[model samples]
Target: MEMLRRWLAAGLWAGTLLVPVHAEEPSVEAGLRVSRIGGCHDCHTQGFAETGGQIDPSMALKGSPVGFMGPWGTTYPTNLLLTVEPMSEDAFLDFAKTLETRPPMPWFNLHYMTEFELRSLFRYIKSLGEPGEPAPEYLAPGETPKTPWIVFAPPQMPE
Candidate 1:
């Protein structure tokens, strides 16, 4: 009986020692949920030609076209998937800090997220593996020149 007890104690101690010491891997789905709510995919993901105007699930959060336009300039959004490369924890923290001072990114508002949430988001992005093909190119300058001087009024107004 004593020998059995000793064996059990040693087994328990060994089991404890073999247990992982680091925190568990962040939940990718949970982080994705938060990102969806946070609108990360809206700006980051490219849309597909589905009947219902669905997002391309294959390209979610993969970043914007380099020259895509909106209210922002000709810059595309960054890929959240960290697939471009593995970002160190410090790099992610620095990126989060940029939200405080950058425009067009709306990072300032996202600054309100807790550090844990931010880390989870980061992990989720990082877990996306690698980036795919580059986004489409922007139109060249003057390729579709604006001829403001030759502007015409509506048909009725012109008449």
Candidate 2:
């Protein structure tokens, strides 16, 4: 009986070792689809010109306009390419985890993604890493350099 037990344990160990150890990388198209569904490019990339929509493929996910304004005041999205540097499967996992802490970043709600789905998104973002021109500096509200929408108040009548 002891001999049978030993044989069983050995077989189990061998079987475990025989299984493939490497994880498969996702296809670029699959990754893009995930990003699209997650709305990653909406805040990360510059807004579209036509319908003011979010599908600007030419500047897709390249980070927000440098001087762009948002509800949080003047700020730009981080260049995801720089954030995903030294790309590796593990690095991708780390990046996905960061989504939890991101603010005004709606896609971070995807904390429930399976490891495979996260990997797909990471791969797609990494594939778009060509350096782009720097965006212009943004002036804060009430600052000297005014935005196009600034309006001056009229003089008040005597009370």
Candidate 3:
């Protein structure tokens, strides 16, 4: 009986050694969790943010059609999946760090997050598999937008 137990253990060990170990894909769930907490779905999901709905399946990370107008310019969120599809993780992180975003983008939030968080988010977005429509072009303060837009109030100057 002891010899049989030893043989079984050796067999299992040898079998495990023969099998190829595959690395698990990065976690989409982790990316989704971070995205939800970070509000990536907000402006990225067309019409969803303003309506206060949860992330829309059709519009997920596809960017809003609406534009936000401020003194600096009128800006639209980019389709995240489409934008990041061509970029490596390192390139994306570098771009995120130095992004010169316009108003209402909350670009500052990205500055506070870690690289691992960004990687997870990117991995999940990449896994979505298809690209979305490109976002509207940014318009300077006085330029006309191709679509309708909401102009924000000017900053209040201190007394």
Name the best candidate (by lDDT): 3
- Superposed by TM-score, candidate 2 places the C-alpha of residue 35 at a distance from the truth, in angstroms, of 0.7
Find the candidate with the highest TM-score and give its number.
3
Candidate 3 lDDT by residue in tens digits, 68-125 = 9888789988889888988998998887787767779899888877777788788878
Error of 1 at 124 (Å): 0.9
- For model 3 the local lDDT of residue 129 reads 62
| Per-residue lDDT of 145 in model 1 | 23
> Model 1, 52-75: lDDT tens per residue?
345566777887663433322234
Evaluate residue 132 in candidate 1 and report its C-alpha lDDT on the 0 to 100 scale. Answer: 68
- List the candidates' TM-scores in order: 0.55, 0.57, 0.74
Candidates sorted by lDDT, descending order? Answer: 3, 2, 1
lDDT of 2 by residue, 17-43 (tens): 867544455667778888777777666
Model 3 regions more than 4 Å off:
1-26, 155-159
Pairs with backbone N, CA or C atoms under 3 Å apart (clashes), candidate 1: none
* Structure candidate 2, residue pairs in collision: none
Model 2 root-mean-square deviation: 9.1
Ranking by TM-score: 3, 2, 1
In candidate 1, position 106 carries an lDDT of: 73
- Could you tally the backbone clashes for each prediction? 0, 0, 0
